[model samples]
Target: MAVIGAAVDSETKQVFDAIARSRSVTTSRLAGALITDFIRAEKGGQVVTTKAPGLPAMGHAAAHAGAKTEQVYVRLEPYYYDELGRLAAQRRWYRSAYLANLLYAHVDRLPVLCHDEVNAVRQVARQLADIGRNVNQIARKVNIDPDRADLSAFDFELVRMLLDVETAAVKDLVHANLRTWGATDVQ
Candidate 1:
Protein backbone atom coordinates (compact mmCIF):
# COMPACT_ATOMS: atom_id res chain seq x y z
CA MET A 1 0.00 0.00 0.00
CA ALA A 2 3.02 2.36 -0.82
CA VAL A 3 4.18 2.45 2.84
CA ILE A 4 0.88 3.66 4.36
CA GLY A 5 1.11 6.88 6.50
CA ALA A 6 4.03 8.14 4.43
CA ALA A 7 2.56 11.69 4.69
CA VAL A 8 0.33 11.62 7.83
CA ASP A 9 1.75 12.24 11.38
CA SER A 10 1.58 9.88 14.37
CA GLU A 11 -1.53 11.61 15.71
CA THR A 12 -3.38 10.99 12.42
CA LYS A 13 -2.27 7.35 12.66
CA GLN A 14 -3.72 7.15 16.20
CA VAL A 15 -7.00 8.68 14.97
CA PHE A 16 -7.17 6.16 12.10
CA ASP A 17 -6.33 3.36 14.55
CA ALA A 18 -9.16 4.53 16.89
CA ILE A 19 -11.56 4.74 13.92
CA ALA A 20 -10.58 1.20 12.89
CA ARG A 21 -11.04 -0.19 16.43
CA SER A 22 -14.39 1.52 16.93
CA ARG A 23 -15.58 0.45 13.45
CA SER A 24 -14.38 -3.18 14.05
CA VAL A 25 -12.00 -3.05 11.06
CA THR A 26 -8.29 -3.96 10.80
CA THR A 27 -5.69 -1.18 11.28
CA SER A 28 -3.68 -2.25 8.24
CA ARG A 29 -6.72 -2.12 5.95
CA LEU A 30 -7.80 1.31 7.32
CA ALA A 31 -4.23 2.65 6.95
CA GLY A 32 -4.06 1.28 3.39
CA ALA A 33 -7.37 2.96 2.55
CA LEU A 34 -6.17 6.30 3.99
CA ILE A 35 -3.00 6.04 1.85
CA THR A 36 -5.01 5.20 -1.24
CA ASP A 37 -7.36 8.17 -0.51
CA PHE A 38 -4.38 10.51 -0.28
CA ILE A 39 -3.00 9.18 -3.55
CA ARG A 40 -6.40 9.61 -5.26
CA ALA A 41 -6.72 13.17 -3.93
CA GLU A 42 -3.19 14.04 -4.99
CA LYS A 43 -3.39 12.46 -8.47
CA GLY A 44 -7.05 12.80 -9.47
CA GLY A 45 -8.12 15.77 -7.26
CA GLN A 46 -11.07 13.64 -5.98
CA VAL A 47 -12.13 14.32 -2.39
CA VAL A 48 -14.48 11.73 -0.83
CA THR A 49 -15.63 11.85 2.81
CA THR A 50 -15.88 8.03 3.17
CA LYS A 51 -13.22 5.41 2.43
CA ALA A 52 -14.11 1.75 1.92
CA PRO A 53 -11.77 -1.11 2.81
CA GLY A 54 -11.31 -3.84 0.21
CA LEU A 55 -14.19 -6.31 -0.03
CA PRO A 56 -14.28 -9.91 -1.18
CA ALA A 57 -16.05 -10.72 -4.45
CA MET A 58 -18.79 -12.61 -2.62
CA GLY A 59 -19.23 -9.85 0.04
CA HIS A 60 -20.31 -7.04 -2.29
CA ALA A 61 -23.27 -5.93 -0.15
CA ALA A 62 -23.60 -2.31 0.99
CA ALA A 63 -22.18 -1.18 4.33
CA HIS A 64 -25.70 -0.47 5.58
CA ALA A 65 -27.20 -3.66 4.32
CA GLY A 66 -30.95 -4.23 4.72
CA ALA A 67 -31.53 -0.58 5.76
CA LYS A 68 -34.86 1.04 4.98
CA THR A 69 -35.92 4.65 4.36
CA GLU A 70 -39.25 6.35 3.84
CA GLN A 71 -40.87 9.80 3.56
CA VAL A 72 -44.22 10.87 5.06
CA TYR A 73 -46.41 13.95 5.45
CA VAL A 74 -48.57 15.01 8.43
CA ARG A 75 -51.77 17.06 8.71
CA LEU A 76 -52.87 18.99 11.79
CA GLU A 77 -56.12 20.57 13.04
CA PRO A 78 -57.17 22.38 16.21
CA TYR A 79 -56.51 20.07 19.16
CA TYR A 80 -58.52 21.74 21.91
CA TYR A 81 -61.90 21.79 20.20
CA ASP A 82 -62.73 18.13 20.51
CA GLU A 83 -61.23 17.92 23.97
CA LEU A 84 -63.41 20.79 25.17
CA GLY A 85 -66.52 19.24 23.71
CA ARG A 86 -65.72 15.90 25.33
CA LEU A 87 -65.15 17.53 28.69
CA ALA A 88 -68.45 19.35 28.44
CA ALA A 89 -70.25 16.17 27.59
CA GLN A 90 -68.62 14.38 30.52
CA ARG A 91 -69.58 17.21 32.82
CA ARG A 92 -73.23 16.79 31.87
CA TRP A 93 -73.22 13.06 31.06
CA TYR A 94 -77.01 13.01 30.90
CA ARG A 95 -77.27 11.55 27.37
CA SER A 96 -76.01 8.27 25.96
CA ALA A 97 -72.81 8.09 23.90
CA TYR A 98 -74.52 6.35 20.96
CA LEU A 99 -76.79 9.34 20.33
CA ALA A 100 -73.79 11.53 19.74
CA ASN A 101 -73.00 9.46 16.64
CA LEU A 102 -76.48 10.19 15.29
CA LEU A 103 -76.17 13.98 15.13
CA TYR A 104 -74.99 14.32 11.50
CA ALA A 105 -75.24 10.60 10.75
CA HIS A 106 -78.02 8.15 10.12
CA VAL A 107 -76.38 5.06 11.71
CA ASP A 108 -72.92 6.26 12.72
CA ARG A 109 -69.49 7.64 11.63
CA LEU A 110 -70.74 10.66 9.71
CA PRO A 111 -69.78 13.58 11.95
CA VAL A 112 -69.20 14.67 15.52
CA LEU A 113 -71.56 16.12 18.13
CA CYS A 114 -72.01 16.06 21.86
CA HIS A 115 -74.54 13.58 23.24
CA ASP A 116 -76.87 16.32 24.47
CA GLU A 117 -76.99 17.94 21.02
CA VAL A 118 -77.69 14.64 19.28
CA ASN A 119 -80.50 13.82 21.71
CA ALA A 120 -82.08 17.19 21.04
CA VAL A 121 -81.90 16.54 17.29
CA ARG A 122 -83.36 13.06 17.70
CA GLN A 123 -86.17 14.48 19.82
CA VAL A 124 -87.11 16.88 17.02
CA ALA A 125 -87.16 14.02 14.51
CA ARG A 126 -89.34 11.94 16.78
CA GLN A 127 -91.78 14.82 17.22
CA LEU A 128 -92.06 15.22 13.46
CA ALA A 129 -92.75 11.51 13.05
CA ASP A 130 -95.34 11.71 15.77
CA ILE A 131 -97.09 14.57 14.03
CA GLY A 132 -97.22 12.64 10.76
CA ARG A 133 -98.61 9.61 12.54
CA ASN A 134 -101.22 11.71 14.35
CA VAL A 135 -102.37 13.31 11.10
CA ASN A 136 -102.71 9.90 9.43
CA GLN A 137 -104.58 8.53 12.44
CA ILE A 138 -107.01 11.46 12.59
CA ALA A 139 -107.70 11.20 8.88
CA ARG A 140 -108.49 7.50 9.31
CA LYS A 141 -110.80 8.22 12.28
CA VAL A 142 -112.86 10.92 10.50
CA ASN A 143 -113.78 8.50 7.67
CA ILE A 144 -113.44 11.14 4.93
CA ASP A 145 -115.14 10.28 1.64
CA PRO A 146 -112.29 9.51 -0.71
CA ASP A 147 -114.77 9.13 -3.62
CA ARG A 148 -115.49 12.85 -3.58
CA ALA A 149 -114.20 14.86 -6.55
CA ASP A 150 -112.69 17.49 -4.22
CA LEU A 151 -112.27 17.12 -0.47
CA SER A 152 -110.95 20.70 -0.21
CA ALA A 153 -114.03 21.47 1.88
CA PHE A 154 -112.46 19.65 4.81
CA ASP A 155 -110.71 21.71 7.51
CA PHE A 156 -106.98 22.07 6.69
CA GLU A 157 -106.27 23.92 9.91
CA LEU A 158 -106.30 20.61 11.82
CA VAL A 159 -103.10 19.50 10.14
CA ARG A 160 -101.41 22.84 10.81
CA MET A 161 -102.60 22.68 14.42
CA LEU A 162 -101.12 19.19 14.85
CA LEU A 163 -97.77 20.39 13.44
CA ASP A 164 -97.77 23.42 15.73
CA VAL A 165 -98.43 21.22 18.76
CA GLU A 166 -95.59 18.94 17.75
CA THR A 167 -93.26 21.91 17.22
CA ALA A 168 -94.14 23.37 20.63
CA ALA A 169 -93.68 20.03 22.35
CA VAL A 170 -90.23 19.55 20.78
CA LYS A 171 -89.17 23.05 21.77
CA ASP A 172 -90.27 22.57 25.35
CA LEU A 173 -88.57 19.16 25.57
CA VAL A 174 -85.24 20.33 24.12
CA HIS A 175 -85.09 23.50 26.24
CA ALA A 176 -86.00 21.60 29.38
CA ASN A 177 -83.46 18.83 28.68
CA LEU A 178 -80.70 21.31 27.91
CA ARG A 179 -81.41 23.14 31.15
CA THR A 180 -81.46 19.89 33.10
CA TRP A 181 -78.19 18.63 31.67
CA GLY A 182 -76.38 21.96 31.59
CA ALA A 183 -74.84 21.02 28.23
CA THR A 184 -72.52 23.61 26.78
CA ASP A 185 -74.07 25.53 23.89
CA VAL A 186 -71.14 25.04 21.56
CA GLN A 187 -73.10 23.70 18.61
Candidate 2:
Protein backbone atom coordinates (compact mmCIF):
# COMPACT_ATOMS: atom_id res chain seq x y z
CA MET A 1 0.00 0.00 0.00
CA ALA A 2 2.74 2.48 -1.01
CA VAL A 3 0.96 5.84 -1.34
CA ILE A 4 3.72 7.44 -3.42
CA GLY A 5 1.92 10.81 -3.75
CA ALA A 6 0.49 10.30 -7.22
CA ALA A 7 -0.23 13.09 -9.74
CA VAL A 8 -3.89 11.86 -9.99
CA ASP A 9 -6.44 13.97 -8.06
CA SER A 10 -7.57 12.05 -4.94
CA GLU A 11 -10.83 14.09 -4.74
CA THR A 12 -11.96 12.90 -8.21
CA LYS A 13 -11.12 9.31 -7.28
CA GLN A 14 -13.25 9.65 -4.12
CA VAL A 15 -16.18 11.00 -6.16
CA PHE A 16 -15.95 8.04 -8.56
CA ASP A 17 -15.94 5.65 -5.60
CA ALA A 18 -19.02 7.29 -4.11
CA ILE A 19 -20.86 6.98 -7.43
CA ALA A 20 -19.92 3.31 -7.73
CA ARG A 21 -21.07 2.56 -4.16
CA SER A 22 -24.41 4.31 -4.72
CA ARG A 23 -24.98 2.23 -7.86
CA SER A 24 -23.89 -1.00 -6.13
CA VAL A 25 -21.86 -2.11 -9.13
CA THR A 26 -18.23 -3.06 -8.65
CA THR A 27 -15.79 -3.36 -11.55
CA SER A 28 -14.82 -6.78 -10.28
CA ARG A 29 -18.40 -8.08 -10.58
CA LEU A 30 -18.80 -6.47 -13.99
CA ALA A 31 -17.65 -8.36 -17.05
CA GLY A 32 -15.18 -5.92 -18.64
CA ALA A 33 -13.96 -2.31 -18.35
CA LEU A 34 -17.45 -0.86 -17.97
CA ILE A 35 -16.57 1.89 -15.48
CA THR A 36 -13.95 3.42 -17.78
CA ASP A 37 -16.34 3.08 -20.69
CA PHE A 38 -19.16 4.68 -18.66
CA ILE A 39 -17.07 7.69 -17.64
CA ARG A 40 -16.03 8.13 -21.25
CA ALA A 41 -19.69 8.04 -22.32
CA GLU A 42 -20.96 10.42 -19.56
CA LYS A 43 -19.66 13.56 -21.31
CA GLY A 44 -23.29 14.39 -22.25
CA GLY A 45 -26.82 13.32 -21.33
CA GLN A 46 -26.28 9.53 -21.38
CA VAL A 47 -29.55 8.50 -19.65
CA VAL A 48 -29.08 4.77 -19.25
CA THR A 49 -25.83 2.88 -19.49
CA THR A 50 -25.06 -0.82 -19.76
CA LYS A 51 -27.46 -3.47 -18.51
CA ALA A 52 -28.98 -2.49 -15.13
CA PRO A 53 -26.92 -4.80 -12.92
CA GLY A 54 -27.89 -5.14 -9.20
CA LEU A 55 -30.18 -6.83 -6.63
CA PRO A 56 -33.57 -7.02 -8.39
CA ALA A 57 -32.10 -10.04 -10.14
CA MET A 58 -31.31 -11.62 -6.80
CA GLY A 59 -34.70 -11.26 -4.99
CA HIS A 60 -36.94 -11.92 -8.00
CA ALA A 61 -35.07 -15.14 -8.66
CA ALA A 62 -35.10 -15.90 -4.95
CA ALA A 63 -38.93 -15.54 -4.65
CA HIS A 64 -39.49 -17.75 -7.68
CA ALA A 65 -36.84 -20.30 -6.73
CA GLY A 66 -38.31 -20.43 -3.19
CA ALA A 67 -34.92 -19.92 -1.58
CA LYS A 68 -33.50 -17.30 0.77
CA THR A 69 -31.32 -15.00 -1.38
CA GLU A 70 -28.76 -14.48 1.36
CA GLN A 71 -29.29 -14.78 5.08
CA VAL A 72 -33.06 -15.44 5.33
CA TYR A 73 -33.80 -13.31 8.36
CA VAL A 74 -37.55 -13.59 7.92
CA ARG A 75 -39.49 -14.24 11.13
CA LEU A 76 -40.95 -17.68 10.41
CA GLU A 77 -42.92 -18.57 7.24
CA PRO A 78 -46.56 -17.99 6.18
CA TYR A 79 -47.30 -21.72 6.15
CA TYR A 80 -46.94 -21.66 9.89
CA TYR A 81 -50.45 -20.17 10.08
CA ASP A 82 -51.90 -22.97 8.04
CA GLU A 83 -50.13 -25.49 10.23
CA LEU A 84 -51.45 -23.82 13.35
CA GLY A 85 -55.00 -24.05 11.98
CA ARG A 86 -54.50 -27.71 11.26
CA LEU A 87 -53.65 -28.26 14.91
CA ALA A 88 -57.15 -27.02 15.83
CA ALA A 89 -58.86 -29.62 13.66
CA GLN A 90 -61.06 -32.50 14.92
CA ARG A 91 -57.99 -33.58 16.86
CA ARG A 92 -54.67 -31.77 17.34
CA TRP A 93 -52.07 -33.06 14.91
CA TYR A 94 -48.26 -32.84 14.94
CA ARG A 95 -47.66 -33.47 11.26
CA SER A 96 -46.34 -29.99 10.47
CA ALA A 97 -44.13 -29.91 13.53
CA TYR A 98 -42.64 -33.27 12.53
CA LEU A 99 -41.67 -32.09 9.05
CA ALA A 100 -40.05 -28.87 10.28
CA ASN A 101 -38.01 -30.99 12.65
CA LEU A 102 -36.60 -32.99 9.79
CA LEU A 103 -35.83 -29.97 7.55
CA TYR A 104 -33.98 -28.15 10.35
CA ALA A 105 -32.20 -31.32 11.34
CA HIS A 106 -30.97 -31.89 7.80
CA VAL A 107 -29.85 -28.32 7.17
CA ASP A 108 -28.90 -26.91 10.58
CA ARG A 109 -27.79 -30.24 12.13
CA LEU A 110 -29.81 -29.35 15.23
CA PRO A 111 -31.45 -32.26 16.94
CA VAL A 112 -34.94 -32.91 15.53
CA LEU A 113 -37.59 -30.78 17.26
CA CYS A 114 -40.05 -32.96 19.18
CA HIS A 115 -42.54 -30.33 20.23
CA ASP A 116 -46.17 -31.23 19.48
CA GLU A 117 -47.25 -27.60 19.29
CA VAL A 118 -45.69 -25.89 16.32
CA ASN A 119 -46.14 -25.11 12.62
CA ALA A 120 -44.20 -26.28 9.51
CA VAL A 121 -43.11 -29.92 9.38
CA ARG A 122 -39.55 -31.00 8.56
CA GLN A 123 -40.72 -32.58 5.26
CA VAL A 124 -37.33 -34.18 4.67
CA ALA A 125 -36.71 -37.91 4.47
CA ARG A 126 -34.97 -39.96 7.14
CA GLN A 127 -31.28 -40.90 6.84
CA LEU A 128 -30.73 -43.24 9.79
CA ALA A 129 -28.54 -46.35 9.31
CA ASP A 130 -30.52 -48.92 11.30
CA ILE A 131 -33.10 -51.29 9.79
CA GLY A 132 -36.14 -49.16 10.67
CA ARG A 133 -34.55 -46.09 12.14
CA ASN A 134 -36.34 -43.06 10.65
CA VAL A 135 -36.94 -39.36 11.09
CA ASN A 136 -40.05 -40.24 13.14
CA GLN A 137 -37.83 -41.91 15.69
CA ILE A 138 -35.72 -38.79 15.82
CA ALA A 139 -38.85 -36.72 16.15
CA ARG A 140 -40.03 -38.97 18.96
CA LYS A 141 -36.81 -38.42 20.82
CA VAL A 142 -37.21 -34.68 20.50
CA ASN A 143 -40.93 -34.50 21.35
CA ILE A 144 -41.92 -33.28 24.82
CA ASP A 145 -44.23 -36.28 25.18
CA PRO A 146 -43.45 -38.69 22.40
CA ASP A 147 -44.80 -42.14 23.33
CA ARG A 148 -48.44 -41.00 23.11
CA ALA A 149 -48.19 -38.73 20.04
CA ASP A 150 -49.26 -41.67 17.83
CA LEU A 151 -47.21 -40.65 14.76
CA SER A 152 -48.40 -43.96 13.28
CA ALA A 153 -51.71 -42.26 12.55
CA PHE A 154 -50.67 -41.09 9.10
CA ASP A 155 -52.39 -37.95 7.82
CA PHE A 156 -52.59 -37.82 4.00
CA GLU A 157 -53.15 -34.05 3.80
CA LEU A 158 -50.12 -33.38 5.95
CA VAL A 159 -48.01 -35.68 3.80
CA ARG A 160 -49.10 -33.91 0.62
CA MET A 161 -48.40 -30.48 2.10
CA LEU A 162 -44.98 -31.64 3.26
CA LEU A 163 -44.12 -32.95 -0.21
CA ASP A 164 -45.13 -29.66 -1.80
CA VAL A 165 -43.09 -27.81 0.79
CA GLU A 166 -40.03 -29.95 0.11
CA THR A 167 -40.34 -29.30 -3.63
CA ALA A 168 -40.20 -25.55 -2.93
CA ALA A 169 -37.29 -26.04 -0.54
CA VAL A 170 -35.18 -27.67 -3.27
CA LYS A 171 -35.82 -24.67 -5.53
CA ASP A 172 -34.40 -22.34 -2.83
CA LEU A 173 -30.92 -23.77 -3.30
CA VAL A 174 -30.56 -22.08 -6.70
CA HIS A 175 -28.56 -18.88 -6.18
CA ALA A 176 -29.70 -15.51 -7.57
CA ASN A 177 -27.77 -13.01 -9.71
CA LEU A 178 -26.16 -10.11 -7.83
CA ARG A 179 -27.30 -7.45 -10.29
CA THR A 180 -30.83 -7.62 -8.93
CA TRP A 181 -30.03 -7.23 -5.25
CA GLY A 182 -30.66 -3.54 -4.46
CA ALA A 183 -33.55 -2.82 -6.86
CA THR A 184 -35.83 -5.55 -5.52
CA ASP A 185 -37.81 -3.41 -3.04
CA VAL A 186 -38.32 -0.40 -5.33
CA GLN A 187 -41.66 -1.54 -6.73
TM-score of each: 0.26, 0.20
Model 1 global lDDT (CA atoms, 0 to 1): 0.52
Error of 1 at 173 (Å): 13
> For model 2, where is the 10-residue window of minimal lDDT?
174-183
Taking the tens digit of each residue's C-alpha lDDT, what string does model 2 give over 86-160? 643423435454444334334322233233211223333321123135445656665967656665665656655
| Residue runs of model 1 more than 4 Å from their true location after superposition | 1-111, 142-155, 161-187
**Candidate 2 Cα deviation (angstroms), residue 5:** 16
Q: Candidate 2 overall Cα lDDT vs. reference?
A: 0.40
Residue 14 lDDT in candidate 2:
69
TM-score of 2: 0.20
Provide the clashing-pair count of each candidate structure. 0, 19
Per-residue lDDT tens digits for candidate 1, residues 1-187, read 2453356788987876656654445677656655666888889867432424332111112222332423233343557546545655664643333233222133211234456657776877887888778668657755766564354765668768867876776666555545434442422
lDDT of each: 0.52, 0.40
